[model samples]
Target: MLKHSQIWRAIDRLAESKGLSPSGLARRAGLDSTTFNKSKRTTREGKPRWPSTESIAKILQATNTSLAEFTALVEGDGIGRPAPQTLPLIGFAQAGQAGYFDDAGWPVGAGWDEIRTPEVTDPHAYALEVSGDSMQPVYRDGDILVVAPDEAPRRGDRVVVRTMEGEVMVKELLRLSEKRVELKSLNPVHDDRSLAREQVEWIARVLWVSQ
Candidate 1:
């Protein structure tokens, strides 16, 4: 778990890296203008309130940050590392096709630049573009997801899992066992899937989504 202060500091660092004030960052992220205001960090009674997940997502999207990067920024270890390559933003429907991204996950074009992101402790952090409506309501057709490979899988956690056959999907982990894992979609119109453990090549918990 992350402390509230750490989260706030990360937000501040992100703004600083971008040469903007906290309120400026909030505006860029499409959130309330007061989102990162120091006065809003705590209540008049001296209680603390953390930024909402939605707000964080907005900030990540506006800043081109991955979940891994944000986690590092919150921890306060250090900064000034090279930024992540700005990848192509594609819709989920295009995911099944070939040649969109390289094997290393870099977008296949010169139209890329680096964006400041918090450091991520999890070694397995990766980003994926949403593909289909099977994950609607919770995830739209074009949302970007950041998965944490080092995080333990648990019920109720959103995850990015790939089958041994090379198909990858994003969904919520509902149940897990030695034999199989059950995944449910956020959209009620989609039914759940249960896949045998042997069929999975990799599974990672989703830490954040930039919609």
Candidate 2:
């Protein structure tokens, strides 16, 4: 059972962790500054007004944090403070970085919008922000992508992968055999790539991308 007050506590903790005020956090999440304000938590008649799920999702997206991390904020876990970790946070054009983010679904930041996601029991599953239109026609700039590191991708599954030689790319997993994997780009203007299985360091199945 979810409690109403837990939402408030979560918001407070997230703001504090990000070194921002409630209003500042709201604004950063591209939400109304008053969305998390204490006054907004009540109605004119003094009835309790809980934060909307939409607003909460936006807040999470803006801060680059995952829902699981936000849960810790409410549980009073030690994660309320921000710690630097290499997680997949790429602009569409810059996603081609090397082994920069975790492939096993580690806890990314919080205060992010909830994009379309499949219900998974794993708490560390999360989405990353796309920066440019390079992955357009499939993924646009500012889009959020849901990634599941635990799932082994088969043929035709879109995935976020890092090459052992140091490069990250989000592409369709075209085919895979014992020794190699082939990938296709969403943009027709872009070409495809193939590599030996041993040359790949990690892969995460991309579940969704929200505009």
Candidate 3:
């Protein structure tokens, strides 16, 4: 049985191996920065607390890591690292334009740049370079956002959503249904959106951010 301490320790070790702080790893996983904070591990009464499986799954997907690999880190004190992978990359402005991606949202044609990352399990993994300071403190200019087009977008996952009209944006998924989708804006100044399913061209889960 995995103890609470072992689970939390594994998270810390995983963050180090990924070159991130605990908060940074949480952000990469599309979760609140404080999700992995030490303070969050236990109740005010000091009873043992465990990390949620959902949180673990998000981090694993964000880092392109498998459960078995994470288990090894837990059992082996965080030894071993996966090899780097090169992926297609493009600027956000370019992403909105046609010819950069196919109908299914896979990178297509040419003019795509490349970025080397670590262990992205999705073969359709790609990177979108943040364009300007518009997104502000959350996503800055030149930040590389790695995305997995084939990955299913779940509530609370930050996602790249493209509209049928050709607009593209990154927002946290609030709700998903057959008729429509709800999105929470990363920037507080921006209003949340509720778009009909027909209006969405494609949705891709954000797996990581290389800042």
Model number with the top lDDT: 3
Q: Output the TM-score of candidate 2.
A: 0.49
Worst 10 residues of 3 by lDDT: 75-84
Model 2: lowest-lDDT 10 consecutive positions: 81-90
Q: Give one digit per residue, the lDDT tens place, for model 3 in 14-41.
A: 8878898778999999999989875466
Q: Quick one: ranking by lDDT, best first?
A: 3, 2, 1
Best of the two (1, 3) by TM-score: 3
Tens digit per residue, CA lDDT, model 1, 140-190: 776777655435556888877667665767778887766777898777886
| Candidate 2 C-alpha lDDT tens digits along 2-56 | 6555567668667877898778998998887778765465453324577888998
Model 3 C-alpha lDDT versus the unseen true structure = 0.80
State every prediction's TM-score relative to the real structure: 0.48, 0.49, 0.61
Model 1 Cα shift for residue 162 (angstroms): 0.7
